[model samples]
Target: MLILAPMEGLLDHGLRTALTRVDGVDRCVSEFIRITDQLLPLRSFTRIVPELLRGSRTPSGVPVRPQLLGSDPACLADNAARLAELQPAGIDLNFGCPAKTVNRHRGGVVLMDEPELMQAIVAAVRRAVPAHIAVSAKMRLGIDDERRALECAQALEAGGASELAVHARTKAQGYRPPAYWESIATVRQGVRLPVIANGDIWTVEDALRCRAVTGCSALMLGRGLVRRPALARAIRWHDAGRPMADADVDPCVAALPWPQVLPLLAEFWQDVCGRVERRHRAGRLKQWLNHLRHAYPEAQQAFDALRASNEPEAIAAWLLQHQELAALAARAPEVEMTA
Candidate 1:
């Protein structure tokens, strides 16, 4: 199955709606919920993975694995047990997030440097969740060195992880420089569980090349899919030797303009309402616009226009006047749903 990597601020409902129709994404993992203390309420778990509470699936019917992030083995296991009640497609342990807040908390990639701790956390979580629900993990090569990749993979597998997804950069790399696909090959050789390669797969060629180099059977897409929603489908079509048509996203995304972007922004904000603060809501919207700008140049203009207007109407009016590109809205209103 093609997996959509859980991006903290990028793969919210609206974004997921858009990417779900792209064709090959069989599943998505919700953004990680950091478990810092024991007795984390059931409501907190549902808030991070609201879809799981609703039905253990994405709006498009794609299975969503709820990912847990933490430093304490017992706390992680406690939360995993509560999440298991939701019957998610699986439980995913996150050891790959490179965020400073997470690392400073001794969660995420910081755990990679402590293999024994990592093993204890995974083993506890595996024992807590039901045997039927798959237990998986996503990780970086190591804290900063290549030697830690295989060792970390072995540790997780020994602890009963059903599968592993390795992002090809280390904690220190933090999305910069090149992703070390060769290191993923090393991790694959060190483990018996299925290995999924992630990082730098922006296009079909990149996917093909990564598979050839790592011999990994599956893939996890992150930034690449955000930049181009149809990418997953394109990769699949390319692999099958099938001709595919491109969505003229430039025109379509531009038609809504910056003004029009507000309501859509509001839609996603509301989806996570009561779960996140207003400041966080607004920040998440801006973060998406930052990435959306890559696909539509007009997005830059719209982004600039909406810089101050957090209100929906103000943002919408700004878009109407600035959007001079072909009115893609007139031709397609449904793409927003798929996007």
Candidate 2:
């Protein structure tokens, strides 16, 4: 199963809708909703995961599980119960975030140091939500090292997490290379619940290697998917034993071509214009184009051209011109043949 990882600031509902529209993502976890001392208003949850209002599914129909982050067991349980009222696909607990601000507040990866507390938090949330709503958790290896990885996985399982997604890195190794897929194998062996491997899966080859090394069929994609929108589709093709081939690229890793990617970008920009504030709209588009640069040289050119401009109008004009160019290119061969 390919699940879209919940990136706090980057993967909001707009991007989620756009990415899931491309094929192969089975589900998605919403960016964590930080639970604190009290129960949050329902609007707060809906704002982060508008899918909640639409049956907890993206516009493309992929189910989205809402994730909650905090340190208090009872408070988390209370909020989980409240969130259950909205009927999400599932409830996910966040124990994997490595942000120092979150850790300083006794949330995120810091909880790994206290497996007992992590267990309690999961157990309480599991009990609070209805039996039908699945309760899952995502966690890193440990705060400083992998010493407590297995213990933490076992603790989450014992606390009633229906499944676990391990990010394959300790907090100290935040977003670095070499995601330690073998360590995921260790945790998978230690826990009875199904374990999903995460971290550093950038291409179809990486996905296959991660699955082979971790012995986990499931994967949660983050920056990888953001960089290559068709990554999940490519991975799915490979899994089905029918890989797609591109003349200029490796058959196993070739994703959506530049022309194909433009429409998706157009759709994303429309969504951003609808929801994001005017002042911040251009930055949002630039953020995605920056990631798209990894896969498409066109994206590099686009990014470089837009780097100095923050005006939404200028960006819109650029998109309009490129889209028109793509259209002309598509008709060029037919025009030449007729001549």
Candidate 3:
């Protein structure tokens, strides 16, 4: 199973809708909703995961599990119960985020240091939500090392997490290279619940290697999917034993051609325009273009072209022009060479 990672700031509902429109993504986790001391209003839940209003599925119909982040077991349970009223696909607890600000507040990866507290949080959430609502958790290896990785995983499982997704890194490792898939294997062996491997899966080979190393068939994709919009589809193709001769020759060909990606970009841009504030709209387009640069040279060119302009009108004009160019290129006939 390929699950889209819940990127806090980058992958909002707009991008979620756009990315899931392509094939191969089975599910998504919404950005972590931080619960403090109060029982948040239902609108707060809907505001973060508007999919709650739409049966907790993206516009393309992929199930989206809502994730909650906090340190208090009772408070999180209260919020989880409230969220259950919306009938989300599932309730995911966040124990994997590496942000220092989050950790400073005794949330996210810092909870890994206290496996007992983590277990309590998960148990409370499980009891609060109905039996039908699946309770899951995502966690890193540990705060600074892998010493407590297995213990943490066991605690979550013991606390009633039906499944777990391990990010394969510690708070100290923070998005670095060489995610510890071997360590993930140890955690998977230690737990009975299904374990999903996450972190550093950038290609079909990476996905296969992660699965082989961690012995986990499931993967949670974050920056990798943001960089290559069709990565999940390509991974599925590889799994189905489909031949992709051009994959090695050109990475972009394995995922999506530049021309084909243009429409998704347009869709993302439209979504951003409607959701983001006017002043921040252009930044959202540029942010996605920056990530797309890793796969497509055209994205690099587009980013360069728009780097100076923050005006929404200018970005809209550029999108229209390129879309027209792509349409024209598609309609143009290919000339046959006489041998």
Candidate 4:
């Protein structure tokens, strides 16, 4: 199974609506909602994941489970119990975040040092939510050591996590290269629940090696999916022994000449413009375009063209009006959703 990782500041409701139209992404986790002290009002959850009102599914019908990030076990449970009233598809606890600020606040990966405490939090959340609601967690191997990776995974499982997605890196590594897939195998051995391997899986080959090493039935995609939008589909196609490139494949991922990625970027910009304030629209657009360049090399220049503009309309107009872009859009094949 393919799962979209909960990427902060990137995969908001709008972008998720667009990306879910693509096949192979089974479900997505909502960007973590910071629960500092009290239970946020209904408006807060709605603002973070508007799709909750729409059956907790993105526009294209993929499920989006809300992820809660906080350190207070009782407070998290209190908020999670309240969130349960909204009937989210699932509740995901966040213990994998590596941000310095989050750690200083005693919230994310810092809790890795206390396996029992991590288990206590998961148990609290599980007890608060109804049994029908699936409760899960996302975590790194450990703060600075892999020695407790197995212990932590087992703790979460014992604490009632139905599933665990391990980022395969120590908190200290902080998203460095060479994800420890071998450690994932060790983790898998200790946990009875399904374990999803996550970290640095950028291609079909990388995924194959991950599954082989960890023997995990599932893999989570983050920046890699942004780089190669069709990485999930490609992996599925590879698994089914189907040809990689058929007619109507994602042009950006296929490495086609003059692949039309600008439309996707334009769609992203339009969504952000609608949901975000005018002041923040341009920055979000630029950030997304910059990331897309990792997979579509041509995006660098496109992003460069907009370095000076902060107005949403002007930035969107630039892509829609440029002669080369206009030509590409004219020739671009209409998007056909793959079943």
Separately for all candidates shown, the number of backbone clashes (residues 3 or more apart, or on different chains) is 7, 0, 0, 0
lDDT of 3 by residue, 240-273 (tens): 8878776454542565788888889999999888
lDDT of 4 by residue, 1-339 (tens): 899999987888777876676678998999998888898887888789888899888887888999999988899999999888888989999999999988899888888888899899999999999999999999998998888888888899989999999998998898889899999989888878999999999888889899999999799998887777777877887888777565555533774332445556667777887778899888987877777777665767777888888987788778677646557566666533321
Across residues 1-339, which tens digit of lDDT does each residue of candidate 2 receive? 999999988999999999998889999999999998989999999999999999999999999999999999999999999999999999999999999888899999999999999999999999998999999999999988999999999999999999999998999998888899999999999889999999999888899899999999999999999999888998887777784565568442365778888888989999999988999999999999999898888899999999999888888898999999999999999999999
What is the C-alpha local distance difference test score of candidate 1? 0.77
Badly placed stretches (over 4 Å) of model 4 are 245-252, 255-260, 322-339
Model 3: CA > 4 A from native: 245-247, 334-339
Each candidate's TM vs. the true structure?
Answer: 0.83, 0.97, 0.97, 0.91
C-alpha-based local distance difference test score of model 3: 0.92
| Cα shift from native, residue 298, model 1 (Å) | 3.8
CA-lDDT, candidates in order: 0.77, 0.92, 0.92, 0.84
Our model 1 lands, by Cα RMSD against the true structure, at: 5.3
**Candidate 1 lDDT tens digits, 2-91:** 799998867765566556644679888888888888767778877677777657776778788889999899988998998888888999
Arranged by lDDT with the best first, the candidates are 2, 3, 4, 1
